[model samples]
Target: MGINLQKGQRISLKKEAPKLEQLMCGLGWDVAKKKGGFLSGLFTTDFDLDASVLCLNQDGKIKSNSEIVFFGNLRHYSDAINHMGDNLTGAGDGDDEQILVKLPLIPQNIHKLVFVVNIYNALERSQDFSQVENAFVRLVNLSNNQEIARYTLSGNGYQGKTGMIMAEIARVGDDWEMMAKGEGFQVKSLGDVMKLYS
Candidate 1:
């Protein structure tokens, strides 16, 4: 079992799981079913949300596009991080998408891994996090398959926002710390999200 992390709360990975080497960051969400006429279900459209990670250097900056792990770019050059794939509909019970992290494989220069999610073609689809429910990001010890921590995003706070900064795993001394961010932004695509750090 893992603690349910509140926004801005952080936990030490090393303390919780001493021998932790690899981690699975799982993100899940469901579309809020529309309350409408009998034909609402028939007219519903699947929402596509993309999970991404920005590998930041010691100075908390992204130097190259290769440092980013996403659906299009499944794995990082250092092989420290790998995006499982994209989840088109978010129509599952568990994680819609997963990102694997090999802590030991992470380069010394890489100090942080930021996990984010942005709606694909948000503007064109007329969608935002406001229509999302049960959005959460969780970290699990890959070695033992035990959850370490989880952060649940409040849907109401994300109205009019298409992008969300879910959480971050940052190197701290000889260990790693995970922080729940749950910050929302009005961005159109991953390119726009990248600009925030560029």
Candidate 2:
């Protein structure tokens, strides 16, 4: 078990799990179940939530498309981050997707790694965070598979939103820190969120 983080809470990875060289970021979400709506029992909604990592430089901006790792680009140029493919449907249990990070291999210029999730083809699918539930991001120490911390969110607060800025792992001096953002955005896709850093 690990600390159940609250939104905006930040923790020092170095202090929590010393000698943490490798990390696994696991993200999960569930589709909202229809409640007593007409025809609700006849159809089940499918969700394709994408988890991405935006590697920002010291100036808090993205310099190239290579810095963003997602289903399309699984590995970072520096080999510090790797996204574990895409999960088309938010089905089954446990983490729907995972991203592996090698702390020591991170590039010197990269100061922050922002974790984000967006509905795939949100505009076309007419889907939003309002149809999602039990969204969470958690950090695990890969060495022993121990959970370091977790941040969870309920979709009830993100009505009409299409994307979410979940959390961030930031470099602070010689240590790494993790912060739970849990901020929802109206952006349509991951590319729209990338524009924020560009």
Most TM-score-accurate candidate: 1
Note the residue pairs that clash in candidate 2. none
- The predictions' CA RMSDs to the true structure, in order, are 0.9, 1.1
Q: Model 2: how large is the Cα RMSD against the reference?
A: 1.1
lDDT per residue for candidate 1 within 157-198, as digits (tens), equals 788999999999999999999999999999989999999988
Q: What C-alpha lDDT do the candidate models reach, one value each?
A: 0.94, 0.93
Query: CA lDDT of 143 in candidate 2?
Result: 99
Encode model 2's per-residue lDDT on 1-198: one tens digit a residue. 989998889999999999999999999999988798788868875899999999999999999999999999999988999999999998999999999999999999999999999999887878888889899999999999999999999536787789999999999999999999999888877889999999
